[model samples]
Target: MLDDITELNENTTFVEEAKTIDEEDLYPFPTSEDEPTTKRFLGMTPAQLFVISIEFFFMVLIFGVFFMIVTERMTIPF
Candidate 1:
C-alpha cells in the first residue's frame, strides 16, 4: 500500500496558475443588438396559448349556457 501511494504521488504533476486575471474576462457580457426575436404573439409559447384557448372555450361555453337560461331558451325540469 505504501509503495502504491508513493508511486501515485510520483505520477502527479502541478499546473501553474494564470499570471494575470481581468474582471471582464471572468464575466463576458454580449453587446450585440441584432438578436433574433420569437414569432409568437405577446411572447406566449404554444403550450401557454393552448391553455389560454382551452380556458376561453370553457368561459364561452359557461356564458353561452347562462345567456340561454336567462332568455328562457333552456328550462330547468326541477
Candidate 2:
C-alpha cells in the first residue's frame, strides 16, 4: 500500500511538471519589444490589400458552405 501511494505521488508530480512545460511552450508570454506597432490602413500596399481581399472572400465562401451543410440544404443527386 505504501509503494502504491509513493508511485501515485510520483506520477502526479510528473504529470504536473509536463503540463507546466507544455503550457510554457504553447503560450510563452510575449515581451514588450515583441509588441506590434499601430499602422494605418492607408499604409497598406495594393498587393497586400488584394491578398487580404482574396483571403476574406475565401473565408466567406467557406462559411457559406459550412452554413449550407449544417442547415441540411446541401444535397447530392445520383
Candidate 3:
C-alpha cells in the first residue's frame, strides 16, 4: 500500500535541488566570466580621485593664504 508514495530522503533531495539552483543564473550581479574587470589607480576610481584632488587643492589654497597673513605678507583689516 506504501508503494504509491516514493521515498524522499532529505540528504538526496537537498543535493539535487542545490545542483539545479547552482546551474541556474538567478544572481543579479555580474560574474567574473561576464566581463573583464577594470584596474583602479591608487585603489580609487576616477570619480573618487577627482573629488579628493579638488579637496586637496582647496586645502592648500586656504592654508597658503593664512600663512601669508601671519607672516605680514598679506594684511587683513580688523
Candidate 4:
C-alpha cells in the first residue's frame, strides 16, 4: 500500500550543446560571468571598506602591542 513517493532511481541525463564563438556577442565572456558594478557605501565600495577595516584592525593591534610593551605589563623572558 506504499505510494511512488521515492524518486531515488530516476535516470535524468542533461545534454548540453557545444558553444561556439559568436562574432555578434558584445561582451564575449568565456570564463567569467561576474560583472563589476559601481556599488558604494559612504563613498567607498565593499572591497574598499573591507581593506580599510583590515588596515584599521592591524593598526589597533600594533598600537595595543606597543602599549603593552611601553606599560611594562609583561615581563621579558630572557
Q: Cα-based RMSD of the predictions, in order?
A: 9.6, 13.9, 7.8, 12.1
Model 4 earns a TM-score of: 0.45
Ranking by lDDT: 3, 2, 1, 4
* Model 2: per-residue Cα lDDT over 1-78, one tens digit each: 234654565545755656656545776887666666865477897789999999999999999998988898995455
Model 3 alpha-carbon miss at residue 28, Å: 28
For model 4, what is the alpha-carbon lDDT of residue 4?
Answer: 48
* Top of the candidates by lDDT: 3
TM-score for all models, in order of appearance:
0.52, 0.43, 0.49, 0.45
Which 10-residue window in model 1 sums to the lowest lDDT? 11-20
User: Once superposed on the true structure, which residue ranges of model 3 sit more than 4 Å away at CA?
Assistant: 1-37
Model 3 per-residue lDDT tens digits across residues 1-78: 134346755465555755666533667687777755786788898999999999999999999999999999999987
lDDT of candidate 1 over 27-57, digit per residue (tens): 5774344444556777889999999999999
| Model 3: colliding residue pairs | none
Between candidates 1 and 2, the TM-score winner: 1
- lDDT minimum window of 10 residues, candidate 4: 12-21
